[model samples]
Target: MTAAVPTVSDAEAAVILARCDELARHSSLTDGIERTYLSAEHAAVNYRVAGWMTAAGLTTWQDAAGNQCARLSGSTRGLPALMLGSHLDTVRAAGRYDGILGVLVAIAVAGRIAASGRPLPFALEIAAFGDEEGTRFGTTLLGSRAVAGTWLESWWDLRDAGGVSLREAFLAFGLDPAKVGDAARAPQELLGYLEAHIEQGPVLEEEGRALGVVTGIAGARRFLLTVTGSAGHSGTPWPRRRDALAGAAEGITTIERIARAEGLTATVGHLRVFPDAVNVIPGKVEFSLDLRAPDDADRDRGWTLIESALTDICGTRGLDLASTQVHEAAAVACSPRLRAAIATGIRSTEPTTAPADAARPDEGGSDSGPEAPADDAPRELPSIAGHDAMAIAAITDVGMLFVRCAGGISHHPDESVTAADVALAVDALEAAVRALAADYPAL
Candidate 1:
């Protein structure tokens, strides 16, 4: 027998997209002289979102640590609940959709469910996590980490670029820094979590697909490299001179070559040279390197190649070199059950559209493309960037749905998405949520 198909109405999808666009203009997660953690502007956006949640028929409240939550109780008492959420913070000069879309979409979905007058089997909680951007405090996912009980005490003392401590910022926002532990929830209390967000990349648009069933979050390592060599007069003969800038340039080129050859993604995003004079031979250079892969072993192998190349280049060029690790996070695989549920929902809701491509064919299943058998689903891709879902994954079963982004441009003022794509994503999410609610009823 064929599985029952679940679907959402076009009207419902439109309502959700309208709400998302409305919220996007307000938080403008992309705007602020600087909304970095603890800034007055950041706090304002948080409070505004909380108010919007309350208006949407949720019992919204702000935690002692400033995290915001909006609760929607189901008919089943004492049943494990599902959390749907995403962050509200943005990177410096970020776009509106990066983190805000997921949270607002959750809110709209919950509102739709409530308006239907059908009592859900399990309760749903919508959260708008704070400070995931790490633009300030130099720490990411502060709100979600707290909820998962993974936040460290040392986090309170962490400072921003301006040397303002997290604790100071918390107090300034009228939140108690010492009460952070209150954010943790019993793992048993949360049955699962789901997030719907923009792809923030070119994949979906390139493939002409409306949805991306996330397979896993990629592993990443961030480090800084410094190349030092003697400064010399600009007119000095090339034969007898040591150029730190030249060595750093060679290192950059080597990194590009290695990453391209290995099929790994490597980036040298930031670079600084010493000395203020225009003609001065640079004595020192510092650059940040970020490398990511689908798994730890692959990520490590890429880094090893990078290190070997750097050492060889520095040694042969008579330049001193050093490296420091800034941050590292391992890849996370989504639950198999959740992945299947999302794909099933997508197929059921939009029969005319193709099924999701299996991200890792060997592990998930075969990707037969559009011509594949009806039983086969397209492959889902792994996301290299960090996401709010990562934090939730640490505590409970988590799944993600990606909406197509226009030109893969994110974290910029010009970031945008089409109205039709937004509607399609909402339909997929609604169907997915209803299916999960039925299959994984509160116990």
Candidate 2:
């Protein structure tokens, strides 16, 4: 359960943070971060990351799916690889560390391992996926799914907001659409996958801990719900009017109540009203529902309850309700073996102290600074947000370690993490690799 180094210094953590800021400079936006899939910005960052990987004694290449990949041989020159990575693409106006943090931390870990002059049971690989946020083309994990050999031919037809097809975008990025298959990795060519990511929720921050172990990624269902009712004049009698907006408001509230009662998450993040004007009653309403749970059965049961409630709300309001399911994904459990390895990593770790400017969560969520952590025991939690691991799960067993982020804020510019946590994260992941190596033959 020991690593080449017991603790990654705060100085190294500062370097990771500095690298993040440097990558942020390649964003498309003039004002904020916005690196989408296959954009010039993506290529620029990949080039920058490749330089870092090479300096760390790894062979670097860009896969057909446009993932930035690097490999370092173990004691055995041609053994299966243990891949460690997270996405590099992001939603528009994203924070500095959502996906970027994982990539940099992984580089630090790999760099340290190579510097140790010791080889593990398997080779090491890093993949900086180009598209996980799906901010540009409306498809999540395209990068990782391609690597998992799950790329759909129809994906070429998918277009972005500017009406550029994925196929065209690939060519624009100097990639051949026909060669994307080359990115796929065979199941036998790897041991397993591990991702170190921000909690992106307040659990760790609230509990005053620096790191946590992910139990599983939540199963999710997304839908577009429409309410139809007739528009009316502002002067229409209340008894005669059918207010779609009002009905939608009631429906959203009911969704919240049912989700709360069921211990699930149901969010109506987007809403649209037709015939919108101060002088007219709304004729129709369209809203989005995002439901998630750690268990597929529990998620389905919660959705059933939600459907019943929405039906009742619509019926009472004399409105017709219709729903179209847009997306669904089953729960992905982290491998028990890998989970144990991560736990071993956490238990053997210690925190590092850095200057305030090095890293600190100061905005809204709990900022636990470089203080002593709650306990050495692993804090286990489920990820509600989707990740690249969700797609990579198709090819291999996966595990994740969650680093506490500022107030659980992500996908925004204010996302924060302290250097103390980053240092601990690097230590834990490095130790996890060693732990896995020790048991590689049995695994």
Highest TM-score against the true fold, candidate: 2
Using lDDT as the measure, the top candidate is: 2
Instruction: Assess each prediction's global lDDT (C-alpha) against the native.
Output: 0.75, 0.89
Model 2 stretches astray by more than 4 angstroms = 1-8, 351-375
Which stretches of model 1 miss by more than 4 angstroms? 1-34, 351-379, 441-443
On the 0 to 100 scale, the lDDT of residue 60 in model 2 is 99
Would you list the clashing residue pairs of candidate 2? Answer: 365-407
TM-score (C-alpha, index-matched) for candidate 1: 0.88
Give lDDT tens digits, candidate 1, residues 214-243. 998888788999999888788877876678
Candidate 2, 1-443: lDDT as tens digits: 54334334567888898998999998889999999999999999999999999998899999998999999998888899999999899888889898898999899999999999888878999999999998889878999999999999989999999999999999999999999999999999889999999999989878767788999999999999999999989899999989999999999998999899999988898899999889999999999999999999999999999898889988998999999997888899999999999998887764532223333633344223454453557789999988989998999999999998877898889888887788888989999999998987877
